[model samples]
Target: MTNTAATEIDDTSSAFTPNLTIDVGGAPMLYRRTGRSSHTVPPLVLLQHFRGNLDYWDPLLLDTLAADRDVITVDLHGVGGSGGQTPDNVSDMTRNAIAFITALGLTEIDLLGFSLGGHIAQEIALVRPRLLRRLVLAGTAPQGAPDLHRWSEDVYRWATGDVTAPEDFISLFFSGSDDGRQRAWEYLARTHTRQQDRDPESSLACRDAQFQALMTWGIPESAKLQRLSAITQPTLVANGDNDTMMYTKNSQLLAENIGGAQLRIYPDAGHGFLDQYPVQFGQHVRQFLGC
Candidate 1:
């Protein structure tokens, strides 16, 4: 295992630094570690959404979760400071994630994955169930979900049409209500707070690869919904009531299919529901993790 000594910062003021790197499968993987873990409580490993890196996390949410338990956020292969070509499928991405976790000497962890990250998390749990103690899937859906292709296509059109405009995010992540729009601006502001040593923005090629993987996962044959029954760990599935990127019903399906999974759908929110209700969501996660 290899890492830089974690630099401490005032928890009330700034987010923790994420300057550590380790070798995984002959490639460099970058991650940020915060908080301290007790003998009984395991560290929380966070996986980023599509085109996201360590810096993309909501500081309020990340700090809130880290206040009571250790948190580790990583940049997947080829997305940020991590080295290697980006995998075009969830299975390969899961393999690299397992490599990164094992390289860090973490035998057990609580996994939290958002959007695309959630898909990867499910794969990890299925492929290597023993490695995880708990699982959290937010703003995501199961494989081969009905109407997923249409929603993904619409989201893609909106996302690509005005990549430079901040307003585009409002439409993509939040609802049409006034409160949702207000929270969308606040969320945008929070993402820009971390200025130094931030990970690079994902390239167009990376985005294309991610969408390809997403479309493939949407196909009925590639879905592993039936295999989800194999997951026995305590799981928390959450999303907004009006999620357009991945329909809210998928969350219901996941909760129903995954035995004993807890589900929460925030009202008047969209794909970025966690960002909309960070404190409440954090509390829910902390309670579920028993921290």
Candidate 2:
């Protein structure tokens, strides 16, 4: 459906159950919109982690956030139900995301991005500072972040493994602690809640392209690293204390580099720390966005 105007259909009964689609630059982009619509505050647009689709979001977290503010979750180009080939780099991803937002007739939005999506969100804020009201980066790193290159091999190994297996998710997202493993299972359960109209699994090509973008982002030569100072949006940086995927120190770096940014680190968690502590995380996000 080619909808240039922002179309909002109310699913008041259950915000977590709706799966909607709109045309973004002539391609179908699948998304879910929930939460209380506000005239004063711009909607919170979420960008998912590597290989994650709109359905991959934790329903408890989405529902909790939606209780007060409008929450939007989308599938990036060529991932899940979105149509088009995946871009090979973060720059194009940022452009496409901007197009998606503009196509929805939104002039301002608050962005929350996780891992690879955080990288894209950073680019978006840098490229068009006027488009954002606030920014939240979770389980992510800045470009040219120290020791960023070390995680690539482990990421590749896990991504190439059986993605549908619970074990793989545990290995990739959580720490070795029993609590972490239990939270991983809960998070995985939430991901499977949308049994109908579910998005397709990310293709190998898309995964490879995302990996390439990630590697490029970690390179010191990438000019985007030097331009982070341009992102003046009120930002929140969050991650697990033991995040092996992106490393926790990067969150601190993000907070330090981005003027006035806040930082949060959850203990005994890994990359999916937000998912691990959905209630506390949701409260923090609500407080940040509300303030």
Candidate 3:
């Protein structure tokens, strides 16, 4: 963990830094920007997991990444504080994300995407190759990977249920061991630190649409893996060794397919390894971005 004292003194650090909105195609996108903007370093734009909003991010992880450069997080359209109905497919979602970036007047950025967000990030790289300087894919898989067309019954129940309990999240994201559960509780507490002005919880519509997109992306087609060859940006692929949601093997597949991409798999962790190993992952990301 980063020193709390240092984070407190830095005005632009932490996840509680303030929510701001920008209009993209007449709809609003809720977002937060942390750390001072740098001319030399492209801002790190974060894309969230399935059903995640701005408040879903871990404060400690955000602060650690914000130590040296700007970090940005946004709610997907029709989710949380953002306006407009959610897109039901990856292509529309990719366009929505691209609109948000261009609306910010940024031509170049470093993208860090998790789960469903990682899928969209790949689309962005392929569609707008010049817009990204680097890419970080965590707990995600390439399109059409086998055994991903639909999640197992247990995961589907917790993930798409109308309400998600603490136990559900812990079971879905963290390892079953004692230490992993301890870290899961800590991560949950940190996310709830923001007392006011927090982004609203994700809606049912958002959940349904995102799950449909995931299912569509997971339909098996070996040729879809070939699409990754066009993503030539410096890439970092990482995940927990026990990711029940996306599965650990997907992360390995990503590293093997993307040319020159580096891979990291943290042991005794699950889908939420970035939060479980926040400090180490943050350091790795900072080093990769070269800020």
Candidate 4:
């Protein structure tokens, strides 16, 4: 009687799938896939922000993009289901990104990297130029300088493990204090942690690990910020005007160097505006991918 019903696979279809594995960094890479149809255009991959898990991405963005093309959202090493491999160095993260793509059998795809993930995106484009079509770098920078500003005192403390849970300090992450700030914070906090995602301590440890590695992570070519011109892919350096983590100039600099890169800045947002400005950002990405 237990075996009365014949076992069947999901031969029908799915609008979205979750937690698929790929081998990267000698660990199973856990990423989520959602799409309207699998046989259409090259897929869109959403790279999570610093110390962020894939669950925090705006569902509106995911749903809209998925309706037109396949979308992959992944957690980086030392985060979420990617096995939390503590990164001793920056190259490991880059290698992890490349490996995830290879494991997915993605030949050329659109990469949308947010905050910390943007750094990884740039690394991939630099090392394996053939693998990328268009790149979107949001609220990110190429290198880190110890002397530069930390997002906030609380953020600096958290990055150093001097504290956990930088609580309300994230208020600085948005310029929309009255309406947008409350709305963004609500979404961020609600989606910030998912039970299925990595626990807070592990995520914190991963954050600490990257902090040490990135302190000295240097892009000599991009130091003089010269060789950005050498990357042959069409790039989009998008940001919010009020992102204190890094200025809008970083976007401008990236655009200027990456041969005809398009720059877009949301006038009323901050670091994570990719979620807040999903439609505009998604449209911009659509155009870039169309190109």
Among these predictions, the greatest TM-score belongs to 3
lDDT of each: 0.82, 0.81, 0.89, 0.66
- Over 42-69, each residue of candidate 3 has an lDDT whose tens digit, in order, gives 9999999999999888877888888878
What lDDT tens digits, residue by residue, belong to model 4 across residues 111-156? 8888677777887888889888778888876664222334467445
Which residue pairs come into collision in candidate 4? 222-225
lDDT of 2 by residue, 142-181 (tens): 9988777656676657756545466777787888898787
Compared with the true structure, the alpha-carbon lDDT of candidate 4 equals 0.66
Scored by lDDT, the top model is 3
Please rank every candidate by TM-score, starting with the best: 3, 1, 2, 4
**lDDT ranking, best first:** 3, 1, 2, 4
By the lDDT metric, which is better: model 2 or model 4? 2
1 against 4, candidate with superior TM-score: 1
Candidate 1 at residue 275, lDDT? Answer: 81
Candidate 1 residue pairs in clash (backbone atoms < 3 Å): none
- Residue-level lDDT of model 1, residues 1-291, one tens digit each, is 111111212435235465788887778888888777778789999998887778778777887888877899988788878888789898988988899898889899999999999999999999999999999999998988866665566577766552536676778888989888777777676666666787787777677777778878877643568888998999999999998888898889889999999999999999989988877898899999998
What's the true lDDT of residue 278 in model 1? Answer: 79
User: Model 4, which residues run further than 4 Å from truth?
Assistant: 1-17, 37-40, 144-169, 189-202, 218-224
Against the true structure, candidate 1 reaches a TM-score of 0.92
Cα-based lDDT at residue 131, candidate 4: 80
